[model samples]
Target: MQKEELYKGMNPLEAAVSGAALEGAVASGLSDPFGSLDLLTIQVTPLAIGIRADGNNFVPIIPRSTTMPAQKDLIFTTAHDNQAEALIIVYEGEGKKVEENHLLGYFKITGIPLAPKGVPEIRVILDIDASSVLRVLAGVLMPGSHQPVNPVMGVRMPTVDDGHGWCAEALNRAYGSTLDLVTVHKKI
Candidate 1:
């Protein structure tokens, strides 16, 4: 085998030993070189993921630069009166508007049991692993209900390519607030 080829195929342990030997040979009392360097790599989220809120705004659940294997939950409510279902649209980006972001995917929680607007509590849970796989959980809680409805959908991130804005608009046009949700903000 060629000398360069033989050296290029060195295993991690072998490369570490050789690098240490070279560093020792180059060591000098002048100053410690390679300082302020990170020997280990840091894990981070590639994109900011969040749900759409009122006024079509993007409410970030997990912001960018967050470490991996992160999870977050946000409470939401129906946008219209006596809503029976809530649609959750998940997007990924740094943009404040959902139209400017990429739609990862969405799920709907039905059988909310007829409640006034902002009365039913819909919980949106986002779970992201180190591999960047995202799983979303939507739980709808209504008064006097035995349990939350089923049809819980979990999907991988980045489910859509182009035309995400059009998709959102179409969904709204078809559903007409039947699956709309808004962030539930409490004062004090």
Candidate 2:
């Protein structure tokens, strides 16, 4: 195709690039102008995904600009010593605090062996599939153990469809850092 046909009323550089693109598309047998038929295109996360940690902080596991079909795990510890149970409250947004973000879901990890604060390891994983579905998994683990003592809990995200703010608020009102977790730096 001529440059005039593919890029009408365009400057020389723009017309050349446009004509080349059209030729490349036709040469490659791409039926869609947007190239949606490509099977391996990338999609980025619309919002940051993380958990509610100590001091009411939003500790991000999968950052907002991360690509989809991503999985990330963060180590967290109990806020108080001998805290036998912890809450894994997931949120999605660009909030520095949990209250500013949307509540995705939550699960409680019980049956933790009693230990001093930050002694036990809690692995919280956030995964986002290419279809934009989010899954959260949390479990308690002993140091140097590859497996969890208790069964890991996996929860699909957006457990609250709307009024998510109130759900977060209600959780705070009901638990108020009693079951809070603190982020433990990755040792490896």
Task: Indicate which candidate wins on TM-score.
Answer: 2
| lDDT score, candidate 1 | 0.75
Please, what are the lDDT tens digits per residue for candidate 1 over residues 13-120? 988898665555544322436653324344688788898878678898888988988998887888888887677888889888887888877777777767678888
TM for every model, in the order presented, reads: 0.69, 0.76
lDDT of 2 by residue, 1-188 (tens): 65554645669998779767766666577888677545444678878889899779999899988988899999898889889988888887897987788888887889988988888888888888877898888888888788897998888876683754787788789988889899888753
With a 3 Å backbone cut-off (N, CA, C), the pairs that clash in candidate 1 are: none
